[model samples]
Target: MAGIAILLDLWRKNQSFNAGLYSARTYQSTQFFSASAAATAATFAAGSSFASRALFGSQVAYSDAGAALPEDYISNIQSASERVFKNHALQYSTKQYDVQLKPLFSAFELRTFALTSLRSFLMYYLPLLEPRVNMEDDDDSLEDNQEDRHVDLVVPFKKSVIQIIRESTVVTTRRILERIAVHYVSQRMAWKILKDVPQSAARKAGRQMPTLVYIYCVSRTTFRGHMLGVAASWIVQVGIDLYRFFTSGFKTLQEDDDEKQVGVLAQRVSVAAVRCISSLIFASIGAGIGATLIRPSRGQWIGCAVGDLAGPVIVAVIADKYFHVTL
Candidate 1:
């Protein structure tokens, strides 16, 4: 009975302790709800006020880059418009842009004009002053006979001589032009190109691109184009020499009837062949010397002419002395 009484007393104490803890927790929760409600009410009151409304409305005000032009932009546009108006006024106004020019003629000019007018007048009128010549009964016959003689005697010789002259003239002109191009282009430019063109291909592709271009212009070598042109010119000279020799020799043979005397045709062909080669060599030497001493194109032409004239004499002399042949 005494142990049961002590147990009952301990149970009552535990129950009383639990009730006090529950009351304390409920009081804390009530205080927290009151404080939160007061804070919420204060926030609502502030939000409804004029200053808060103004602040909130001002936060996201209307704006864009196109809404207003910059001060500098407006000023620049105004300035440009003024400049255009000023330029236009200056350009079109008679007071600003009026210009006049009058030609002044000298005494010499007037005399020249008068002389030209007189000459033109004379040319236009003077031809009608002459009376027409009367035709004879045998005039047609005489004209026909003259035409026939011209066709037979003059035409063939003239045609042959003219053809030879034309060929020589064309060849000579081509050579002169080639020499001039070489002197102007190669000597003036090729050496500089050689210096600038780099040996390394990698660098050529990079910094020295113009050097590569120059090297290409050089025919992939040192003034190779000029050398090739000279060689081509020499070959052309040989062909020209052959034509001149054959044509002149044939004409001479026909005039003198010397074919029978010269014996073998082979010897004549050999002599002519040797003559052309020897002449070309002599011409090259002479051109080199003349070019070194004088203006390149003029010197080349002069030297070529001298060598050309002397070449035949040299051949003739050689034939007379060494070969005992008159070629």
Candidate 2:
């Protein structure tokens, strides 16, 4: 019985040992599987993150590549190009006017010549009508009395006329030239501003609208239609001068002079008429040249019209106030 009991104890011990071993093996397997699963999950997460980063990088690159050019930059480049073109056009136009138009217009030299001739005629003829002073007046008392009397001597009309012509021509020419120079500079500036605006904006504004905008911009600035105004003023002045000179000469011939010689008054009137007419014609020519050369936008035209109308008046005011010119 003791031996059997000892054998039973041994068997129980073996079975207990085996059961503990099986439990430990199952636990180890579970642990191994859990570790593997965790590792796989971690790897997947890492891969996902890497993929996300790569995608983000690609997206950023695409966006950068697709970015549009700056509008202002484009506008600047286009404006620069247009300015270059306009400058060349202006240069060519100037050359054409100087070489071609000036020569053709020279036939109108009569316009100025008539004025000068009339002045010369009046200066030579009018003095005859003045009362002659007797060098033989004998009495000392009478001489002394006459010397004290301020004689209202009539100016020979011819001499007066000539003087008027010379003065008017000088004054008118100076004003016309100044106007031309100012207009040219102003137009150039306006063109630069107009060209500098973006092509996209211009296109969006459409044909008539853009032109109007350009005109408006130029007019508001010092550059609007200034050239045309300058030119027109010159033309008008010249035309009026020529008309007066010729008309005065014809009228002088028709006048009845009681002395049978051209009176001082008649001569003076002729000279004055000639001078006035010549100045007017020269002014007109200058204006015509400006109009031919300056091609402003429609808006510019409106601005030019306003400037043209105002230019002479302003010049006159300046001359009267500062230069002491007879307006």
Candidate 3:
């Protein structure tokens, strides 16, 4: 019985020792789990703080870029616009002042003056040089009549030649003056007023503009461009008319009797005035029409000249037909 009791006590003590070892292991496991959890929480908090700082810095950079981008774009546009306007202004100024003129006494002009003088001389002098027959010197009365008639005709022929040459000179002078005025006085303003007829016509045609509109535009442009030319022509024509009137008046006063001279001077003056006005009007109209039709520099010149020549004839025809008067 004592041996059996000793064995039971040993069993109890072994069981208690096993229970204490289990309790210690449980406490150690719990402590390790708690420390691991605390470390994970601290790591998570640090990562969150870093992420927030990075996000905030990115937002600040984006906002700065957003604000700066529009300002930069606007500045670029403004600079580009300024450059374009400056270039346009420079080009306009250059084009405005660009003008070229021929020398005053150019070869073509000299030739023209020479030809005009020669033509005038020939027209006046050729009729006087009739194939003369060697007649007997004893025909005194016949010779005297021939001399009187020759004297009367020669003076007029000489004066007519002089008048033509003078007119030609005046025209040549006027052209030079006009060029000078266009270059120095009016400058680019005149060029703007003057149309480039062929180019303008072509542009208008491309746009399908009407013929009447083209004609009107071209005519108006021609008139504006040749205003000085027209004025010069009028002055010259009026001067010529005055000269002829005075010479004719003097001749009439000498030849015609007192009764016939009463209203003849006044009538001649009126005729001269009518002729001058008719010439100016018709000339302007002709130049316009010619420029419209021809569309070239030479065309305008030819038209003006033809108009000047035909003005008197047209006036005479109209007067003779409608008014029963000869100009």
Candidate 4:
């Protein structure tokens, strides 16, 4: 019995010790699990906060932080292009109008104008020296045809004289206006304005192009070259019209009638515009045909001059004959 009791005591002591150890372990494990859970929650919260902040920062960077919209980009491009065009135009004008650096008149211009006037005078006078054509048309091949002879020789003579005077007056007026322009504009600009259309056309004809394209190029070149002369002629015509309008007492009576005045001005402008366009078209055609036929320079010059002179007459004749629309 003693031995049995001793064994029981040892067994009970071992069991109590084991039970204490197990309880301690269980408490430690529970504490560790709690700490782990807290650490994991804190880490999760920090990660979530960081992810949300990143998303918000990215949105701000895209929306309001130095980011350009499509419209802003296009506006920038347009502004840059406009600046470039403005600069180019300024540079070109500067080069063309460097008046202080160059003389207004040169010997070449004077000689050329003199030659032109002399040639024009001869063109008119030489026809008089030739045998009087029985027919009015110079192209009439049958000079021997007595049936087509003019009965009134005095009328034809008067007509010739009037034409010569008219031509001389035109040349003088153009020269005077050209010199006046030289006073305000640069020599280069003035020269360009008065440039020979035929010479320019001849030069441009070197390039091979379709017939229609060639004609168009010639016409465009001629128009540009003759712009100054056309403008001067239009100005003269407008001045005359205005003078007549004022002299007729319309200005005094209709002083308050701004609409009437504007209408008259517009009508005059339209007439001038039509005439100018017709003259240019005819001149361009002449230049092209002349350049193609005769020696480029001489042919172009003669053709252009003839076309410039005859264009208005032809238009007038056509209007009177076919359209009954007097210009």
Candidate 5:
């Protein structure tokens, strides 16, 4: 019943978001037409002697005002075009920054890294992560210490099974939620970028319905290079992590903090490197699997997207079980 209710709620939210998007598009169309009409009128009045005189007292007065007719018309169009282009360029830059960050998509990215890095080294091994919120430090500590979160059973075997199921469900749901949010925000950012004026970061990044990314990865080849790229990226990230693990300065953990918080340049670089590498590997794997199942290009794209998202979590889990070392 709970799952059904959540599904129904998500469906409703999706419909609402689609409707809002349609309305926004309609509004922008209206604005564009109006602006076009106004520009046309201004240009006509400025260039034609009769229109200029009729509109602004007299041709003599217009010329006295020092407004060159052709220059004004040309400059107006140029300015409008430049404004539109500049706004779009800014949004493009933001998107590029986002791609560099990888699995740390939006707000959850950093916290995800921190949790994965911290928990991997702890003596008491907890594989699942709790969601971060803006609560007090003491509240966070209390929550962290409660190891039986989401699953509690007396028998070790039964408890482990239940825990794994519960954790997997939670992890999967969170990933979906984050992906949905990122997808929508990205669409909104695209629209915001194309405007004559710049949009606020909050306006572009805030709550929105899930929408497709207007842009996508360019996978032009069916060669095995995609998979090779994935492996290469992972290897590079592992190398960087090892380098950072050895060179980065030690930072003391906060009194209430559950994990060691390192603040060295090497650590930051390694985290970013690892994220990018994982993203590439997953994308390649996804593309290959998808191609086998469907159209090569479409399948590749779908696979790549899924891989990019799931890759980080997979890496984190592998590290937790095998490496069992802290950064």
Candidate 6:
């Protein structure tokens, strides 16, 4: 009976320990669930408060005066954009006129002045110098004397001829520049005229003969005027050189020793020459087509303008493909 009592007591102690452990685990689980529920409730309350504030703020904003007239606001923005575009177009047109047409015109004027001065100098000196003549003595006894005299005359005559050529080159170059400038200016004006007039009216007008005539006349007149100037400048330069050569006793002076500054003068002359010749050739072909066929009607003008702008690009392609030229 004593052994059984002892065994029973041990079993009761084990059962109590197991019950205590289960109770402790149940309490921990319940505490964890309560804390999670409280956290969930707090989160829900915060979310609801945020939603209410956002809804109220939206209502208040809509009720304000600034929130209305969305279409008017969009239309105003569109109208402002259109105005800006129009302003930009006008400014672009003006810039094109100034940059494209004005510089060419100025160059033409300068070329004319230089050519005129050259021609005047030439006319003044040619007759006085009698540059084309070869004087020979008829004294048969002095054969060596006759030969020396002929040589002397030939040298001066040769110099005179060279002077004449140089003068002519300047004149020709000036004429070309002037012609190009005139054509460019007229075309620019034509563009403005078309833009100013109503599109329908301009189309109905078809060919503008008066405008064409104006362009031609201006080109011709400017060319003639500039050519005269170039001729004069050439003659003048020649005269100065001749004067210096004669004064120096027919002795050939070193180019560096000369006060006439031939190198700088030559460079200027070359620039004028290139500008005139290139302008003439380009204008005769390029500008001629642009003004004649392109300027007659609006459609023609548009086509011509596109072609004109694209001309350099076309030439570049040709040069690259055929001539192996590159930039």
Residue clash pairs of candidate 5: 104-109, 230-281, 286-303
Residue 48 lDDT, candidate 5, scale 0-100: 52
Best by lDDT: 4
Candidate lDDT scores, in order, read 0.46, 0.44, 0.58, 0.59, 0.46, 0.45
Model 1: per-residue lDDT, tens digit, 1-327? Answer: 223223433543465455566654443443333333334333443445456445543221211122233556545555665676677788887532211211222212556455544554454345445554445559887787567444243454455554444444444544454445445664534343323212222233344345336334322332322343334445555555567566767777574445542443446555555665556555555544443345544554455556655766788898899988775
What's the residue-level lDDT of 6 in candidate 2? Answer: 35
Q: Which stretches of candidate 3 lie over 4 Å from their true place?
A: 1-94, 99-109, 125-160, 172-185, 189-210, 237-277, 291-301, 320-326
- State which candidate, 1 or 2, has the greater TM-score: 1
Task: Please provide, for model 2 over 1-327, each residue's C-alpha lDDT reduced to its tens digit, 9 standing for 90 to 100.
Answer: 223323433553465555556654443443333333333333333444445536555433332332333456445555665676676688787421221112222322676656755665666655555565566666996777678565443545545665556545544554454444545655554343223222322332355444445434333332322333334434555556556656666666755543333354355445444444333333333333333234333333333344444545655676679988644
Error of 3 at 20 (Å): 88
TM-score top scorer: 3
Residue 28 lDDT in candidate 5: 44
Please, what are the lDDT tens digits per residue for candidate 4 over residues 165-252? 4444454556666667678876886666666666666676777666667667666666666665666567667766777666765536
lDDT of 5 at 51: 45
* TM-score list, all predictions: 0.27, 0.22, 0.49, 0.42, 0.24, 0.26
At residue 70, candidate 4 shows an lDDT of 44
- lDDT of model 5 at position 130: 45
Give candidate 3's error at residue 35 in angstroms. Answer: 53
What tens digits encode model 6's per-residue C-alpha lDDT throughout 1-327? 223323433553565555566654443443333333334333333444445536544323322322233555546555665676676688787434432223323323657656655665565555555444335655664676556445344555566566555555655554455455556657564344223222322443355447656345333333332343444454555555556556663464666645455554555455444444433333323332444444433433343335434544655576579988541
- Which portions of model 4 miss their true places by more than 4 Å? 1-196, 208-212, 248-270
Candidate 5, 1-327: lDDT as tens digits: 223323433553465555556654444443344344334444444555664455555323433342334555556655666676677788788433232212423223557545643443341234334454535568767777575355532344455554444333344443444455455656554333222111121122233412221112122131222433344444444555555545532333344332333334456656656776677666655655664455545555566678877977888788778998332
Report RMSD (Å) for each prediction in the order shown.
Answer: 31.2, 28.1, 27.0, 24.3, 25.7, 26.6
- C-alpha lDDT of candidate 1 relative to the true structure: 0.46
